[model samples]
Target: MKINKEEKTPWICDKCNKELQLSEIKVVYLGGSFEVELMQCPECKMVLIDETLALGKMIEVEKGLEDK
Candidate 1:
């Protein structure tokens, strides 16, 4: 239930017009941050957060925060 990690390698960045590289980036929500693997624009540092990661892990974290 995650984005195409292997299928979408060497992505083309929309902003920089450069090839996106697989890298680790930090995602922040509700004053918390966590590392996530993603294809990102190396030049402009734009991260492509997948729908599965957002709907799955991100939502779960938000819900956990609410319950705390």
Candidate 2:
């Protein structure tokens, strides 16, 4: 099956709010939800990593709790 490419979403630095265009950004899909993907803002390279890590931690915590 052919996957339709998603239109690029506007990306901004979470700390500085710097805007980035598609050419200046990198996206990695984790095979699911939008948040599961890594979005790197070239202008700052801040929001993407920061948000991804935060989400990763949240997932970890939830998994740990569930394993109990």
Candidate 3:
């Protein structure tokens, strides 16, 4: 699905405060149209979605790391 560029908000890694890129990241659905960007830094493990919403489902195919 084409991500809405207008809705593509800039994400900064909490660990390093570095800006994220779509090509070097991923979106794990956590319900209510929220998502998680599974990055490499340890801080990336933090929930990327709304805290009020319960985490829905996470699917990882091919067993490849989000960032090469």
For 1-68, candidate 3 gives per-residue lDDT tens digits of: 88876885667777678665433344544232324444343445443443332332333322233433
Span of 10 residues, lowest total lDDT, candidate 3:
54-63
Model 3 whole-model lDDT (C-alpha atoms): 0.44
Instruction: For residue 9, give model 1's deviation from the true position in Å.
Output: 6.9
Q: Write the per-residue lDDT of candidate 2 for residues 1-68, one digit (tens) a residue.
A: 87668865666767667775333333333322223345555656653455655677556656666777
lDDT of 1 by residue, 1-68 (tens): 97876784567888789998889888888866788898889899888888998898898889889988
lDDT (C-alpha, whole model) for all candidates: 0.84, 0.53, 0.44
Backbone clash pairs for candidate 3 read: none
- Pairs of residues clashing in candidate 2: none
In terms of lDDT, the best-performing candidate is 1
TM-score of each: 0.78, 0.28, 0.27
